[model samples]
Target: MDATIEDPRLSTSVEVVFAKQHMPDLRGQVTLRAMAVSVVLGIVFCFVGMRIQLTTGLVPALNMPASVLCFFLLKSLVRLLQKGGFAVLPFTRQENMFLLTCVITCLNLAITGGFATALTGMTSTVAKTLADDPDPRDIVDNVPTGKWILFFFLIGMAGVLSNVPFNQVMIIDYKLLFPTGTVVGQLVNSFHTPEGAYVAKMQVMTIFKAFFGSFSWSIFQWFYTSGNGCGFQSFPSFGLGLYKRRFYFDFSATYIGLGMICPHIVNFGLLFGAIVSWGFLYPFLESKRGQWYETDSPSSLSGLNGYKVFISVALIVTDGLINFITLVTSAAINFYQIRQERDSSELTNYINKLHPSLNYDDRKRIEVFLANRIPVSGPVAGYIACAAISTVAIPAMFSQIKFYHVAMLYMAIPVVGFCNTYATGLTDWSVTPTYAKFVIFVLAAWIGRPGAVVASLLASGITMASLHVSSQAMQDLKSGYMTLTLPRAMVTGQLFGVALSSVVGPCIFLAFQNSTKPGAPVGSKQSNYPCPYAALYRAIGIIGMGGVKELPKYCIELCVISVCVTVAIDTAVLISQKRGWSIHSYIPSMTVIALPFFTGPFFAIDMCVGALLLLLWRRMEAGSAQLLSSSVAAGMICGEGLFTLPSVLLNMFKVLPPMCMKFLPGGQEVEVVDSFLNNSGASRA
Candidate 1:
């Protein structure tokens, strides 16, 4: 009997390999219980991801964390129900993958939506950063929660549907290695094996322990944050002088865990950026404050801060453009090659021959994968309907844009979606933000100010949400291919997940807006939520309208120099890679290096600490480090993130902490103590 053939009288070895599994279907996968689990976990991941996006301007990948938690929770549920004598559906790998897909879909939608960057850029919070007298008109009225929810759904669904046609091209035909998706696929499969299950159990235990400790630490830290510049968050571990430059280890579990997850180059790039901008560049620019600009105010765009914002923008925009061009060229070449190759060879046979390492079960998995196919027409029809609806509805929602603008945008989605997905598969990097920058500039220039900022942001939201969702969908599809799960099930899960997220993301953003002072003045020693990217996006919008010539003295010159430097570095790195030089990986990414210019160096310090700890652990015990690293990091990140909701509620209820603890110089400390004693004596008298 052929091992790949389905038969009732198969051999024992074949049976063992199949595990008596029927044709992979969505029966147990998309059950009510699965959706319930997905939604719950999805909400948690979304909250954490959104919080990170708003604060640090970076949202770490949550797919593995979601997978880990889903497996643990579902496995526990099945066991508990069985022990209680209740009839419970046995947990399966398909269900786990389904849940992971849903949770990750929801998470990506929440964090990648323009809420943290483009949308926030139009608010008064970010407006105050661009100019001392920002336009009241630029402070567009906030979209109502219900309206925002609808907007997200319309765009998000459109985005997800837009890429379904390419699943075959990216996942099957071309065989692009979506790194994260591959990791997730392998992870899902491993969790079903005996040894893998044991390791997963250990991972779950480590995660919970880290979660508890991190959550407790957050609670403890909250007690000392009664006043500004108080608590461990403000601790100047690098001493007061360097701390003033935003270089300090604040012991943040979230950032530290993120550091553990991120590559060393990312952490080093951040620290390098901070040192360059805050420690050296900013100080140098400030020394010429009297000579360069009239006012020394950090908040004014014409002052020292202008150099920071525009210079960072120059680096970001230049880097984005260079990478965008590079990716598009690569994708185009690959597409050409694929077309040429398809002319001479059968795709399935080619695929089979491509992976000689794949054993019989793996081959069988591929057979099961290709059996069920989603028709191309279905996605095309869906995409057209969405595009037509979005064209009409988006213009109605935002008066700055016309129906034709969106119609024009939709025409480009197919080409952009393909490129974005292709690039993502090749590099595991999404250039959606780069796409958004392009849209922002083009639309803002077209609309012209009074309404250009709002128009730019709204246009950016559409482009970004669409491209981001599409790439994520393709990534998930790759995972689906590997797991032998139905593509239709993946789409259904994503649809539900995104629908839930549309409402959840807006509500959370609204909650943060209502509960915290995100609109407070900039340049404070500390802020509840600085939303640095929001301000930077606003700067981009303003620059898009006014042109670079309006920037303060030497700002454009500095920007040009920064762009040239970034280009030179990128060129050097490319050359090194082509030459197969060992030093290429050690080179810091230009994008990561530019991030700290907006957010400051505080989180960078925390991340470096995490990376350092991971390095030492790896040196000590490579096996345990590899085993517990991600799980422990996930636990710590979730613990701190889960506490954010309660903290927000506490702030809302005026439940203030009782004490403020801060370190000061000896003379300042004595003065503060004397003042307190004097005030107390006065009260007693």
Candidate 2:
């Protein structure tokens, strides 16, 4: 008997490997209830995902939790309807997974389009600050609202269109192991068995408990504590503070969850980077550049922090370039090997080989079923139509960009999508920003124009959005593959999601914009949202367009040195791996190396704590460590993440009275002193 023909009843356990052989009837996989549930949840999560990104600079992949949530909700709804003697088929596993994927994909689209646009405006603010003649007005004032809207719309469309080809390449041909997708696949399959259902229920309950617990804690921490002395911070002295800063922990559940999911090497890498920047280099820089370092103002801290971010960017870029080389070389070798196998193998020569037992009609039916099982061209037409619309509409909508530039963007979509997909496959970090920067850099170098900054922003926005969508799409396809879901159903669900998010995301962003004081600078007191990612992207855009001249000389030097050190370390790891050294397995990831610096020491500290705790747990009880990590850690993440949306809404509506406690009066005093000094400096100038 073929291994693929195993009966489900005989199979005692559910596993992702089973998906390869377990082909189910695809006709009823996508039901009306599933689509309706998906649409409603997709819209809800779009707002939730956008709010989460805007608030915390993190977007929790909600597919797993949402899947469990949908299962329970739908089951309850069915039971209620059945009480009235109405016949309704319980949702199949495929329908449930499809619904969750739609919701998660839509949520991601919201974050990609809405959040990217918000970041663009925020980046413009940073650009003005860097200008010789700084402007006090909001950076978004210069760009027309219609142009911004149209730009976001095009980006969303591009992401949806490009995702199809990228998904086929990454999920089908390359067979990248999307870890999150695999986990989700396993989770959805668990609903089939009684024991699995019980486990799933527990997981759902754990998430709810953790979510409300964390949510309540967040409210108390923010409202009652006045947002002071909640997290550990460094001592104020320059000498001690440098070392102490690395120990700063925010006590966030989000970071703890991140640590639980991420590899130990990643956690160590983050800690190592934090130590290098805050413990050693920052102090050294302070001594060497006293005038630049000695400042009490919050803005000055941000300025000094830019050096650390620059170092991170340098390391990230260097690591990315090396990875790109390795990917290209490996791909060439793989292609050659595949070609050789195809030429030599008898199976490859036989195109229409069917079982001898099957009759002609049976063979034809099987062929048609297999062809429909995996969609090749139905989605292609939709993708092409979307691409065509974007190519034509973008230049017309945004006059700053020319037809040729838009054409160039269209040309680069496949390249960027492939690179990002491959990179994410390897590191689970989409170097979208880095690739965007490279795109902008090449374009700026070629154009050599004054509007280079604007061009860079626009190009980066489009590239990032497409890459974001492609990455998510590939991940979704992986989940579908693992769950034995129909490829066409997954594609259809994504299209519906993209369409919904395209509208929901922009509306949410526009609401925020309208609420902001008309003339107030973005990231100021009057503006409610602080966009950290936007700041990072803005810095990249400026550097891409204007080169090192846009940054301080010292920053340039730091960036160069950082890149050199990163390359050396990576090379050592590569050599060690080639020699099959066991110790080499622990080499840090570039994504982790740059995370602490970008997110701040506080975030790193929490993650480190979680990683260490998990390490200890594994040592104590190896068998249960996996279970504890997945359930408890995931609950913590969902709890904190879901709670933030309501928290933001409450704050937005002023449901809670303002509360302040001066736990650190000296910090306030220092702020006043900094304000006075800044005023004096301005007057003198």
Candidate 3:
């Protein structure tokens, strides 16, 4: 086993806590203290995930950061105990992987459990403003934290349980490379070694420095905020004229950090989308306001609001429907090929064929992994129970969703789960949002108007949560396979994470919900917590129920034109891929392009700035840029996100800033103040 590693992705050597591969056993590895630490880390990530979900609706891969932090803290605790003359077991790679599994699962629920998206999409705050004649029964007054926690827990549990049977097929037989999972395994294994620990210490310190800087900056920005739209967040970085068009920077460290973490294509896509919709389409639509619709209310559905909501909806739904069909077809063909390949050979022989391709350390890892087999009956029974309960209880909780609807959704879960998971395995992207969009339109059309809004939103939540958890479980399974962690332990850690996040996710979401006027009249650039996708999701439900009738004049035609354009773009990319052309990567994604239309173009500028910084860093020193960019970016993101809850609390307590800084078109501050005072006096008189 003392041979050099063949694959560039695999580590050079293997190390474990005990001399033997499985000496400590699964029970000893998952101790009480490890779980306690996992919960603490889970809360921190919950805060970060909630911030991303509400602001940009773009969450980067967090497995690497989470694993790094886990190792740093645990190692520090062990050394401190040793210094105090207390005997403690050394931290192991297995323990770190277990903690990572728990933390990541919780973080996923916080982001994708639909608190900021579909759930808020069904609320009265978003619905009434967007739709002309929204149904009273379809719009929920509020979803309390307690009830939301229970709802998330039920759906989350079902998602976790449904993916257990596919482990052998995806991991052992198909031998798919979940790149994120592999990176996480390599990180965990490397950190436990003496050489790897030294490198981790440097990364941890770098992260802390970046985190402190970001946190301090946010605190500084808070002191100058005297009133509505009176802080650095509203700075007109790109001249006042463009700022009026919602194209100025918001001075957000979180967004800058997110830009660094997100791929370059995503950043460029947001910019391109912003320029297309806000810069051109919206302006033209506004010019035709009086002739096309009316000049009565500024927020009228037959005016700019219709153009903003329905046009974006048309692009999103068209993109989602096309991708859904393509992915399903691809999955069907792949499954058929696999079945045919297996017909002439035994499954074990197929699994053994993967052995020669791997290095010595990976071979050892595989050996240790297959020894601790997970039971099928446990997960089977668990899924059946959760499915049965959810089928009955979900409809009871939300009246719009009937027992038949829940039954139909549950039947479709396995197929959607497999397709999503398979696609995730190949490319490190989760298309749950696309699947959720398709579900929203289908269920809305099935149930018809009035009640369709509530039913579609609720059903999408259930579908998204389940598919997200299933794909994530498969990824973690691959990580476990590489790190030699017990499959049973990995499953248990996932469940524990679901339990913790069931409470944490809801509580954080409620804090944001109550703290800010989410889904209110405040536009995406003006509001601190705009929850952009919620508005988009609600608009989709409305469109699904009303069709072209709900749209303004010329809007439906524009929608059709946008659909055809998107189809042409996707077709071009596919053809380019088959012809060995490298041009497909340059093209922006359809789903990402639709995002900035709803959220406004301000953040796109911030993200591009971040990508520019990364480019500059790479130009200076490539190695340091690759290693420390994510760590520094994550620190900045977490630092600002950590302050979000506290900032909300400060707002709730009626704390006010001492000074107000105003920026006007002509720099006539005194005139503005005098005009404000005169208006106030006239109102009183």
Candidate 4:
């Protein structure tokens, strides 16, 4: 390929020649069998994904890589059967990409549903904690089921619709790099060549082997370990008359995979927060405050919790402002450039200028292609209608909220969508939670104490879900653009996915909730699942609604300090970026900054281990590290995720005995021989 090309004609010619040489056999592209397989796998993966999130508080990406692997494995089986006197068809690359897109969309929805479940579950947990005489019934009764279902569907559809135009603008026109999506596109394109297919197949096999290894280990650890399903836990005493502080990592494959994908700076920042909160602040507070540290739990506060709350709030606010400003700045620069081009007739002259080697007809074809790719009127109208319906229906469904409140939320959707789209485009991190919290806070303040709680919760849920859906949709759109797939087909596949996931996700959440023990807080040992993210959001909602009066004095003080620190750090980074400093890339993202504050210190440690392993691997084997990392990391993730489904079921049904064995000095063992009693308690409670 040429390193430099200035003429549009030459660029078009190059792409045409390349396509002719590399295009895959398209016999099976976009067929009914492909759609069916995609839908089935999508539904199954979405259910499993939700289950994983609810149980472990980790969401797995079930997209191009995973889906492609699944497709080829199935294809291989079909080929084997055909050789054994049975006819079977092979899948095309385009069909695989389409199927992958569908699965990705569904996975996104499943995650959204899981988050919603966590949100509502945590709200109940919080309410119980706050109430003098807690009743789980009161909390459950208050949730309007019909209203929720309607709201979910409307918001989900609206999210899909609202993403289309932004997808076109950001992905097609501006060509923003959706990194993961780009990788998926490349993988799909590579399937055209035999070498690429062999590499992909090897990766698939590696992932399967890793999956089985991790899965088997999980069963042993969950059933046989002294901790009874818990990860490696340790309490190291500093011997300063302070109580031993708890520290442990959840040795799960999913988190390790996440570490592989995330930047080292992010993992380091998470570890940094954990060290500051648990290692330094917790110990220091124990010394000063004495018994207060001992009494405090993960959800409740000691001085450390107070500091975390304040710091998290500060980061959220600061990150939101910076994201908004960045979006506006980018827009302004683009507008200015476009204006200059139009004013100088540069754009038109450039368009009219043809390559000396090209004829007028070739130039006209290029012009027509560009014109055809622009957003059509039909899709624009459809999106507008969906948005309008959602805006009106949501407020009407819930009588507690005023119409104007919903109207304001509806108005903010487009703004939030654009900001989130741009933010993801620039940083590959969706700061939707920050934007959601900002919206919730504003709405809560406007609604006052009487309606503040409901307003904030509803606002946060809608904003978070919509933003998440739109961001993922745009990423898929980027993939579609790269693979030269029809936008309409991609949209239709996504809509099918959305429709199915909207129903499947909620059902899985409700079933999980019903099956689990009632009256237990989310993270408690007795509880069936832990939803750290939901708990974080719930805490934010409570603060937003109740205002500063609800916060402890220490928290307020720390919030002030956090503001100063966040501003200083952001300013320094901004200056560094302006000066073209490479170090700016190492700066921790808002997600990393906020993660340690909510989740346990162990998760940070687990992710750090994965990141460090990758770093070491890269150092030792620079050339092959890229391929090795993708296969191994993905295998580790998928292995744990796919296995969690059966493990959950086994635990639920009491098929596995609750027996614990200790190897450590202080560790003790518990053997529950009565299977009936164990199963009965879970069923009844």
Candidate 5:
């Protein structure tokens, strides 16, 4: 890497390579086109995604967060291409189309049936417990719309606060208007000619817009009233029918019910946090950590890849089982519905109960039976359970086990969430309304949940890693587009990102889990479920079966191997790419893809493979272009990071008094945190 030659005559290979990398004359129309292409592609994909959502029962996020993702990835690719040239941006339209189509299909399947994915792991566990019991299948079918709405509304309220912190962090990275700082001292270059709008018409449109926007989401829920099932369903029990509605529980969902949703950048931010905290700082915390920071800028923190892989393997395998369970759960429900339909008597009974003219054949009795027979449960703190489980597991796994517990902690929140929230529920991890009573089950079977934790960790880590890598790669991609150093930029990018996630980690704990739920104000949907875990315990009190008090050897062995895979995959990835790429990347993905294939099909694998291919293509580029590609990938992780950013910042508002001046006269002119990325900008620029 040392470019200076002792003698002018001693022209080294390093010097030659360095000169080629700094190509400046290539900038011109091509760069503009790349920018334009990125924007155009973003809009195109957005509309395509919207159309798909409308045309099919499938939503894009089922396979991928296609809408925002399209924008981020395309932008990253276009810039990478422009910097590295057209050849650097490889496109396999055949594979991409195939992948897209597959994703769409998977989206349909997932919406229709992919319950056992990364999001549904813990949730499915609870459902299974309920199903296994002889209790009526009422809870899932009879929740009130108001209650469902309230649960989500509270979750939304808890999450939206992250927006501010997230946006601030994002603004620091994206260089929104520019790739750096805000433009200042604008001269009157172009005159608007003081154009004025029709005041009366403007006011009316604004009023109408406000009204429609406020009620739009509510109105949209009408379509789902019929058993079309898009999170929460209402079944009329008494005179109506047994209402079995779902509450909101999208594993990858970053949206609040508010008009706004979490953007892709936040996903990148979360990734940024993981890379810095785990990938970067972790090694320093390790014996081999010197490789991460001891040498120089652009230091490859590839060492942490093992930690990621190790954790991921455990999660991926368990998750696959969880996904299979989801398929079975959905199939069971569908089959049960079909069986009910075949029974003329059952059909007649159901119809009569729904009849407007239910003759006095015991209408009061029917109402009473409906009231007590079925209780539709709302979204539970199952995902929170995964997070909490990770929180507990962190110290144990890392300190006692002496491998990489932090990685385990970080990975489990999302990965476990992905699995347990699914439908069928992993055999290892169970979910049932009755299981909700087993809050103490965790204390009993902490290790059993490691599989669950791995799933959650994957959810969190992959989300983070994908986002961080993509974003950093994107930034490095600018040929003359940026002047930052690749290694420096990578680290700096992570700093701003982790700063956002620091709060997200805990917010998920407090909000969705709502630690202060019982303390919530009167009438607040936030429950006063005094020791709901007691209920879980009481529900499972028969065998004391909630979490694993005694997991089978096969299950324990599987978890042990899974943990090994997690570390192995992370290590392989970290150490894999010496010249171009190392062994780590493909191994972890292989382990994941391989896990659930035998049990059932993961149609969404199509999209992921495509993404992997894209990642590979960028990885081969290996320089500026690689930087760009990784940046987009990192976007996924950052999205999660952005989730808690606002709360993190808001919590600091008290310390940042006279806040008005942050924007005023001589406020501290802040630069992008990635300034460390600049080979020369850390000082003057």
Candidate 6:
């Protein structure tokens, strides 16, 4: 091949060697046998992982230490069985880098989780931080917000950031188990760096995207966690002074992505059952007068069953209903998305108009085509909102308790998040609309609910979605973005993410609840978007529609500054268009992000050091990335926040003891196998 003739491929067939690109292999080549097998394995792996995640709470740690360790060993075993005749965890240069990163990350988690626990213990009573609530000893008031500030900071460091090493090691650094027939290999991610200036934008956008998306979790956390609640603690409504919100309704955690997003709906199903059994069934099943004096309690209604039985029945009934709705909605969404994409008539319109803006070149044409297909804000979201509102309102209507509140609530949250630079990125705004920026400016003016808080929030969310689409478009146009291949397609993964997040949210919220605080709730559930905003808007809603005057000039100043910064970078990109700069070339300062998040007196900065070290290994040696990533996983298992620890510990005790008894030199169990083998049919004969 001549150098003048550009191949436009990663590497030519003959030139591809393990020395380059790490993936330089014949496996990637399209072959009848290899392709078929890859396809089958991919599909099977994906099927198992996705379905398991539906109810398993497995994903959180599956890609981490315990699982990572097991998988690595298995990978080694597979290699041993291969023609190479070597069985080893591919502790290539990359794996080493990954392990280093994990070591640092684990150190960080330990420091942060430990410090926070210690601080909480020392500053407050032990009963306060660890236990449920305060005693009935009639004590003095405490500083709730102060407690929460500490709580949230520590939790963020240990749970989210500190775990990055493990995540990178497990997912990015390894060949993941992906679904069949997908571009991503079986359980492994397949990502490519895009060409041109857009790459920088994509990289920056990813950081912000991840930050904003994950930060949104805080909204749900604000409601349920009394220790860190915005104002959702046991407010003295009934006048006893302290009440934990957990005892009321734990709606936030029902669906936050582990399960279905709406646990309450499922609970409502149980409520329905209660109505049937108590109102009708129990009335008829009364032994003579079983129905006559069966008061409010469920136990009394049932003839001789213990209260525990009733409680168990209630839980089962509620969980079932929630799961049923969740399953249906999830299926409907997936089907609708698939069908809408397949049957879209817009393709024809887009095809006809492609010539004007897009280059005739095949690559350019493909990019443009994908760009147009990216949906904008407001296509399906409004309907989804309307459905949610109607469902909530139907129950309210029957109960005669007006829920005009939620009607307005369903309208607002997204836009507010966008204005705060934390857009949910729910909607794809491939095309920006006129006056969108101005509307955002107006909405972002206030801190909370001005009379129509819901509308404002909805507008903000839609606007943010639109902006995200625009950002994606910019990256597409610029050609500098590094595309990320989440092993799981975002659509399905996002659905699962939402479900799990929502389900765990309420539990997290309840854990952090504290009466004395005022701010976003801790471990707040995102199931009900309003749960966070309700108190916030209630607090600052006085700013009103004419909030333009009330808006802090500083906030506006910050927005302007951000816009100016974005434009300056854009200008730089435009100047460098002819001779492109690697997207990283232009990003001058990560200092702002690094100080509070990466460094400072917070958690041990060792984790960030570890991550940075891994990055270094990527450049210095081949295969280092894989090595470092695996190491990180091992380190994390030995660190804080071990999600699947207990189960594995039990399994270890079960399997290890038996294995030790049999395999250890001079052990008692060696004779057992020997005796059993001797008693076999052949021996007996």
Best by lDDT: 1
TM-score of each: 0.94, 0.79, 0.93, 0.81, 0.26, 0.30
Per-residue alpha-carbon lDDT of model 5 for 380-399, expressed as tens digits? Answer: 24234433444444344222
RMSD of each: 2.8, 6.9, 3.6, 6.2, 30.4, 24.0
Off by over 4 Å in 1: 1-16, 345-363, 515-526, 547-549
Runs in model 4 lying further than 4 Å from the true structure: 1-29, 43-64, 70-90, 113-118, 128-150, 166-168, 225-244, 288-307, 339-375, 388-403, 511-528, 547-550, 662-685
Worst 10 residues of 2 by lDDT: 228-237
Candidate with the larger lDDT of 1 and 4 = 1
lDDT of 4 by residue, 1-685 (tens): 1112244444544234234433333344455666666666775676556755665454545564565564675467557777899655554555667777777777786677435433463355644433323333223334545555666676677677777766655763344677877777677767646777777777777777776787777666666533333323222222212222335554667677778766788778888876776777656655645443343443443334545555665765776677667665775676466446445544335333313344333343333334435376665687677667766786676544666776666667777787677667755667676667676667666766654655566777777777888888887776666566556656776777777677666655555555444455444423545565554554465565554343334556766776777777777788888899987787775646665665546667677888988999999998767875766776676666556456547647766546654223232322343455688888999
* Model 3 / residue 116 / CA error / Å: 1.4
- lDDT-better candidate, 3 vs 6: 3
Write out the backbone clash pairs for model 3. none
Residue-level lDDT of model 6, residues 1-685, one tens digit each, is: 0112224364433122212444211222212222222222222222222222211112222232222232233334445556567543332222221221222222222222211111121211322221123222211124343332332222222122111112221121121112111111111211112231233233333333433442344343343433322232222332221111111222212112212111222223333333333434333434434333332332221222122122222232233333334334544564455445435545333333432332223232233223323243332453344436443643232221124433332333233222221111111111121122233234434423322322332233233232332222122111111122111122212222222222232222233332112342221222111121122221121123332232211333433444454445445644565367665343422111211110011111222233444456567874734433433322332221221232234334542211111112245676776778788956779
| Error in Å for residue 382 of model 5 | 25
Which window of ten consecutive residues has the lowest lDDT sum in model 1?
517-526
| lDDT: worst 10-residue window of model 6 | 595-604
Clashes of each: 0, 1, 0, 1, 130, 90
Candidate 6: residue 521 Cα off by (Å): 8.3
**Higher-TM-score candidate among 3 and 4?**
3
lDDT of 4: 0.61
After superposition, candidate 5 runs with Cα above 4 Å error: 1-126, 129-141, 173-313, 317-546, 549-553, 577-581, 594-599, 602-685
Report the lDDT tens digits of candidate 3 across residue range 262-295.
8899999999999998899888887886688874
What's the lDDT for all of these models? Answer: 0.81, 0.61, 0.80, 0.61, 0.28, 0.27
Q: Sort the predicted structures by lDDT, highest score first.
A: 1, 3, 4, 2, 5, 6
